[model samples]
Target chain A: MRDRPATEARILEAAQAILIAAGPGGFGVNAVAREAGVDKQLIYRYYGGLDGLLEALGVRLAQWWQEKLMAGLPQTPVENYGELIELLALQLLHIVRSEPLALQSLLWELTGSESFVKSLSASRARAYGAWMAGVRGGLEPPEDVDAPAINALLIAAISQIALAGRQADTIIGLPTNDPATWDRLEKSLLRLVRGVYARP
Target chain B: MRDRPATEARILEAAQAILIAAGPGGFGVNAVAREAGVDKQLIYRYYGGLDGLLEALGVRLAQWWQEKLMAGLPQTPVENYGELIELLALQLLHIVRSEPLALQSLLWELTGSESFVKSLSASRARAYGAWMAGVRGGLEPPEDVDAPAINALLIAAISQIALAGRQADTIIGLPTNDPATWDRLEKSLLRLVRGVYARP
Candidate 1:
C-alpha cells in the first residue's frame, strides 16, 4: 500500500538524523523507528532492516549530486566560456558547503563496507569527471599548456577542497567563506583549465 | 632517568595502536597501558591521562608538519621559484595518501572537546605568512598574472588535494597513486606558476 513507501521514507529520514548525531554509532532499528514514529515492524517491512535503509540512503545521495551538478551546464559555445567554468565551481562549492550532509555521506561512503561500494555505481565519480572535462574544454589557452595533466591537477585540487571542509580558512590561516577566497579559487581553476588546453 | 622518556614514548605508541584498532573508543588508559606493556599508573604519571596524551600527540604531529614543510626552502629566486611550489604540492599529496591518520586527527580536532583551534597562535600564523611571502617573492610575474590571488589559490588547492583522499583520482578518473598522476599534477601546477609569474 501507499503506507509502505511513506514508512520507508520516514525511516530513512530518521536514520540520517541518527547517523549524523551518533556518528558511526547509534544506528539501530529501534532508534530509527522511534524517531520516525512508526512501528518497528513497519520499518522492517519497508526497508528490510537497517542495512537496506542505508543502501537506499546512499543511492538517494548519489542522485541528488547528479541533479545538482547538471543544473547549469552550457547549452551553447559562445556564452563567455570562462563564466561557465566559474559557475560550476561556485555551484559545486555551494552545494558541498550548504549541505554538510552531502559531504558526510561521501565520507561515509569512503569508510563504508565493501558491499556498499559494490551496490552503488560510481555516479558521483562520473559527474565530477565530466565537470572537469567541461572546464578543460572552456579554456582559452596559450602554447605549452598540458590539457591532460591540468585535468589531473584540477581533480586533485578539487578533491582536497572537498575533504578539507569549509573551515580550512581557520586551519590554514586564510579567511573563511570570503568572496575573495572564491574569486581566487575560480581564477586559479580557470588558469588550470586554460593551461591544460593551451596549444603546445 | 631515560626510563621515564621511554615509558612516555611507549605509552604514546600504544595509544596509537589502540586508537587505530578500536577507533576512539579504545583509548582508555588501562587499555593503552596493556597495549604498551607498561603499568597503567605510569600512563597517568607521565602523560597525566588520556586527554593529556592526545594533546601531546597533536603537538608532536604539528611539529612534524612544520619540519617537513620547511625542509626545502628555495635558496635563490630562479632555483627556488617553481620547484619550491612543486615540492610543497608533492609533499602534501604524499602525506594525505600515505598517512591518513593525520587527516583523522585533524577531523577530530574540529569536533574535539579540547578546542584545538585555541592552540593556533598569532606568532605561528605570522611565521606561516612570512614563509608564504618568501615563496611568492621568488616569482617574477607576467603582465597579466594575478600574483597575490594565484599564491592564495595554490595554497588552498594544495590543502584541498590532501583532503580529497581517494576521491582525487575518482574525480579526475585516474588511479590515485600513479606516477603519471603526480606528473600531471606537477605539470598543471607548473602551468599555474608560470601563468601567474612567468615573465612575458
Candidate 2:
C-alpha cells in the first residue's frame, strides 16, 4: 500500500521540480501526476485538484523559506538596526538568488491569480511576517522610520534586481548578472540601508 | 490586400491583449494569430514566430512608457531631484497598477526565459535608460547616493506592491490592496525618496 503522507509529499516535490523546470505554463494535472509517479486521478482524489495541490505546494514553500532563511546562520542576536537590515537584506538576496523555486514563487505571485493570492501567497506572507517577527528580536528602527515600507521597498527592489541579474540584462543600468556588478549592487544596498536607517 | 505595417501592428496589439488578459501562459502563436485575424503562417513568415513578435511588443511597450510617463503632466520642468523622484514614482505606480501588460512583462522577465531575457528585456532596458535621461533635466542625486541602485530598489518595490495591491493582498503587512493602505504606501514611498535624496 502506498503511504498516503509519503505519496502526498512526493507529489509536492514533483510539482516543485516541474515549476523549477518548465514554469507555470507547463503546470497541470497530467504532468504533475506523471512526475509524482502516480495516477492522474490521484491528485484530484488526494488534494481535491490542481488548486488544492498548488495550495499545498505553497504551504510547503512557506515551510521551505522558513527553514532556508535561517539555515546555517550564526545564532548571535543581531546587534543593531543596521546590522539587522544587513542580515535581512543579504539573506533575502542569497535565498532568492540561489533558489529558482523562490524566484518561481515571486513570479507566480505576480500573476495575481486568485488561487495563488488566496492560498499560496497568503501562506507565504504569513510565514514571512512570522519570520520577520522572529528575527527582529527586541531591536527596532528609529521612531521616524517607516520601517515596514522602507524594508518592503528595499526587499522588493533587491529581489527584482536579483531576478534580472540572472541574465546579462540590466535592471535600470545595473549589470547585476556580472559578479563584480553584483558586488557593487550589494555595497549600494547596504549603503542605502545604512543611509536610510542611520540614526541622527 | 492588407498594408503590411498595419497587419503587423494588429498582430502586436493582439499579442499585447493576450499578455494583459491571460498573462504569458496564454501567449502563443495560435492564440495570437486568431486574435489578430491573421493566418498562423503569417506569424512565422513576418516576425520569425513568437520571439520576434514579442521583441516588437517590447519595443512598442517602451514607446508606451515613454508617452505615458508624460501623458498629460505639466510642461514645467521637474525642479529638484526629490520632485523628479515623486513624479517618476507616482506615474510609474499609476501605469503599472492600471496596465496589466507592464506587470506581465515583469513577471515574464522573472521567469528567466532566454527568449524573453535576450530580446524583450533588452529592449525594455534601453528604453528605461533613455527615459531616465530624458526626465532628469540636469538634477543629480548627492555624491554619496547610489542613484541607480536606490532608484531600482524604489521602482522595484513600488511595482511589486502595486502588483499585489490589485487583489486585497498584504505585501509584508501593508494591506496594499486596500486604498487607504495604498495611500499610506505612496506616502511612505515619497518619504523614502526624500530621505534617500536629502542633501546637506
Candidate 3:
C-alpha cells in the first residue's frame, strides 16, 4: 500500500525465489509474503492478488528473455548465417546454465494452467518467429533444409537439455554438468547448422 | 484381499487413469480406490501401497514403450543408418501421439522425486544407449557429424514436442495436432538425418 518501489521489487524477488525453490505449486501469496518479510495485506494492495502477481512476474521474465536474446543477436544484419546460428545456440545454452530461476519460470509456464502463462508463451513464440524472420532474411539457407523446422528443433533440443539437467546428470552418455560436454554440444550444433545451412 | 486377478487389473487401470487425468499429484490410494469403485483396502492388499502401485504402473508403461519401440525398429541389423534414424523418429512421434498416459508417466518421472521414477528413467536411458550403440555399429557417420550428439538432439526434440503438445497446439508455426504437420516433421527429420549421415 505504501508507494514504495523497493517493497515491490523485494516482493517480486521473493516470488521468483519461491518459484525456483518449489516450482509453480509453491508460489502462494503467503509463501511470497513470508519470503519477502512483508505484510500479506501489502501484497494484496500492491499486486492486487496472486494472479496479478504471477502475471507481473511473467511479464518481467519475458522481457528479460527478450532482452537477453536481443543482446546476443548480431547488431548489424547477420553476414554469416553459420556464425549467427552458433551465437544464438551458445546464448541459449548459457542462459540455461546460468539462470536457474529463469529456467524454472519457463518450466512453470510450460506446465502451468494460468492464462497469463499461455499468453506469455504465445508472446515468446511471436518474438521468436520475428527473430527467425529477420535472421532468415539476412542469409540464404540450403534448399534441402527447412530453416524454420531446423531452428525449432535446435531451440527445443537446447531447452529440453536445460530442463533435464535439473533432474538428471547425464543424457545418453553426455554429461549434463561437465564444461567439456557443453563445449562439445556447442561444436556439434555449430557443425550441424553449418552442414544444414551453409552453401558449399 | 480379493483373490480375483481382475481386481488387480482394475486397480492398475484406475491408477493409470488418475495419472493421465491429474498427473502424479492425484495418484493416491484413496483416489485410485474411488476411481476404480473399489474399497481402499483392495489397493493396499493388491498393490501394497501408493509407492508399490506407482512402481507397477512404471513397469507396465516401460514395458509398453519397449514393445512399441522394438516393434518399430528394424528387425535385422540396420543396413542404412539414415533409414534407421527415420524409423526411430517416427516411432517416437507415434508414441507421443497415441500414448498420452505414457507421456504423462514420463513427465511425472522427469518432475517427480520418487526413486522408482528415477530408476525407470535410468533404465530407459540405458536402453536408448544400447540401441544407439547398435545403430552406430551399423553405419559410418560423416567425420563432422557426432552420432551420439545427433541422437540426443533428436530424442530431446521429440520429447519436448510431445510435452509441448500437451500445453500448446502449435510450436514455432508447426501445428502439433495436425497429421500433416507431423508428416512434415517426419520428412524434415528424415532430411536432416540424411544430410548428417548420408555419404558425402
Residue B87 alpha-carbon offset, candidate 3, angstroms = 1.1
Question: What would the per-residue lDDT of candidate 3 be over residues A4-45, giving only the tens digit for each residue?
Answer: 799999999999889889887677999999999999888898
TM-score: which candidate is best? 3
The DockQ score of candidate 2 comes to: 0.52
DockQ-based class of model 1: acceptable
List pairs with backbone clashes in candidate 2.
Answer: none
- Summarize candidate 1's per-residue lDDT along A1-200 as a digit string, tens digits: 45766777788888778766654345678888888888888766777776777777767766777777776565655344335544565666667656766656545544444455433426676776566466556554334555445544554455445544333344245455676665666666666555434423
CA-based DockQ, model 3: 0.51
State the local distance difference test value for candidate 3: 0.74
Quality class of the docking in candidate 2, CAPRI style: medium
Q: Alpha-carbon error at B46 in model 3, in Å?
A: 5.0
Which lDDT values do the candidates have, in the order given?
A: 0.57, 0.74, 0.74
Provide per-model DockQ scores.
0.33, 0.52, 0.51
TM-score of 3: 0.88
Model 3: how far is B152 from its true place, Å? 0.7
Clashing pairs in 1: A147-A196, A160-B160, A160-B161, A161-B160
lDDT-based ranking:
3, 2, 1
